[model samples]
Target: MRAPGDLRADARRNRELIIQTARTVFAEQGPSATMDEIARHAQVGAGTLYRHFPDRDALFHAVLTDALERMIALAETTRKQEGLAWDALSRFVEGCAGLRLDLLISVAGSQATQVATTPEIGEGRARLLKILDQIVSAAHDEGTLRHDVGAGDVMGAVSLLIRGLPTLPTDLSAELKNRALRLVLAGMRTDPAPIPPPVPAMTANDLIRRLSTTGPAKPAT
Candidate 1:
């Protein structure tokens, strides 16, 4: 057997290779592609693949969660920029969306957002949600979006972004992503005038707390 340190190093290397191959395969085939193809392309043995992900869905979940976390990081970084609420959020979302096609495709049919129940997924989710909520509530508070739209509704919007995942070209440009986000954002707008000021950083807990004091924080992006 290998020493623990050696095993850890090997696992990390395998994970990086898997994530890289998954990004490529997912872009080409979406989430339903066979594991054999992934293993073949990555040039790793099936046993090694299984060692990292016990099943197809487990692999898909890992890929998906990793993607959303990247977006969350973008959101946190973008929120500090000074500008109109819509532009800041739009640029961040569009920027992340541009980079997300592969990850989104990997988990497309599975709908397995693995972020909430999985370990280490929270730091990313909380930060991502906080940024998203900040922009969303900011829009409502600033009269950019409708006031009646709830955070659940915003979550539904997030799901729509995923559902539309397969359709979006993996290599989209600044203008195209903007067009797509605009269409989606427009759907959630309402007639109520703005009254509430934008809230602080968004979080899964805070977003869920708004939904119900008792419900689970939404698990996926």
Candidate 2:
């Protein structure tokens, strides 16, 4: 028989494969996709998939976690680039917004309370928010974005746009999204720094929990 530790490692690797495969499926097909499809895509045995992710929502949450990681990475990179605050912040949001599904999850969870708050999701979102706050702050100080738009407010607004990442209406979805981000930035600009929104009570973590629970309902094949 295989050593217990070795067996555990192999199991973890397979579990990761399931998560990776499911993420691709969710991105391509949506959150409601069946486990059967996910298994096929991941090339894992059906039993293996179930062993790793017993519930549909668990698998869905994994996909969202992956997406959040990507968003945080995007924010981290942009914060390093030297540019006009408005320009960098605009680009960052647009780039980050490309991860549409995750953003939508947060928005839905925050407003709808469809998903209860979860710890894992809350941690992932905090990193993304921190990055956004940094970018917005730089822009605000440089007077690139609206001086009135508080960095916190900008982060929240950008999160919404990303959450609603929609299929591009025209042939150029990307171009349109960037343009929209710019408009949002322009609207936020003040001579000093952007102001924040009124207290709504729900934090980004609350929204992430909602997202983790609900996921993107992968549509039927």
Candidate 3:
């Protein structure tokens, strides 16, 4: 495939439109969303969609890559602009929630693991984790974050807390997620409570390994 930069202006616009549309459709319909459905939603011809992303996996990979790049940029901006480490961290988490990453990952299911194995995806994840580690360490040094939790723990919590609950209206679901995020943020603050004894802090490496092995949770019967 041609590099995005090499594409004509119209082609580039079409590609972006497809990706954005796919991101939304995938979030709503999961892996079962069809190529025809995506093409119709993107308002692009089947040929155009195929030209950019030959298969569902390719499109999914592109969408995730786009999201990771956006996230990395958001984290960098947050760190630069927010004077207080904790404030930066909180802003970054909120920004992530807005991206609907939890919904994307939940919908991707085992496909996420497959896409994660790609070099681009793996490298993106590593870079994001490195930036997150820096922000987390700063928060720790500032004595604002709980001593017991690590960057991985915070990330894991955000992934869980931001997921949209099934059967809720979009507005209500977003409200609930925001409320949950606020609660999780409060819990992450210093002196929240006595955490259970001896649970090892989750490191970035631990998270990386886990993602490689685990799919999304199975739906309750």
Q: Against the unseen true structure, what C-alpha lDDT does each candidate score? A: 0.61, 0.63, 0.79
| Candidate 3: segments with Cα more than 4 A from true spot | 109-111, 191-221
1-221 in candidate 1: lDDT tens per residue?
23224567768788768877886687666656678788889999998888888786677666766677677766766767746675565566456555644455345432455433465566656666777888878877766666776555665555545434333332232333444556656555453222222235446775455446433423221
Cα deviation of 55, candidate 3, in Å? 1.0
Clash count, one per candidate: 1, 23, 0
List where candidate 1 sits over 4 angstroms from the true fold.
1-13, 101-127, 149-151, 165-178, 185-221
RMSD of each: 13.0, 10.9, 9.7
Write one digit per residue (lDDT tens) for candidate 3, span 3-84. 9999999999999999898877777677788888999998899999999999878888898898889889989999999998
When 2 and 3 are scored with TM-score, the better candidate is 3
Against the true structure, candidate 2 reaches a TM-score of: 0.63
Cα lDDT of model 3 overall?
0.79
Residue 35 shift from truth in candidate 1, angstroms: 2.1
Ten-residue stretch with the least lDDT total in model 1: 191-200
**Residue 106 displacement (Å), model 2:** 9.0
Q: What TM-score, over all chains together, does every model reach?
A: 0.58, 0.63, 0.82
Q: Which has the higher TM-score value, candidate number 1 or candidate number 3?
A: 3
Q: Write the per-residue lDDT of candidate 2 for residues 1-221, one digit (tens) a residue.
A: 23224558778788778867765565555555679988998888899887767777666666666677777777777777746666667667667666555523532333223322467678888888877777777876776666567757766776666545344322233444555565565577664234233235446786566556655644434
Ranking by TM-score: 3, 2, 1
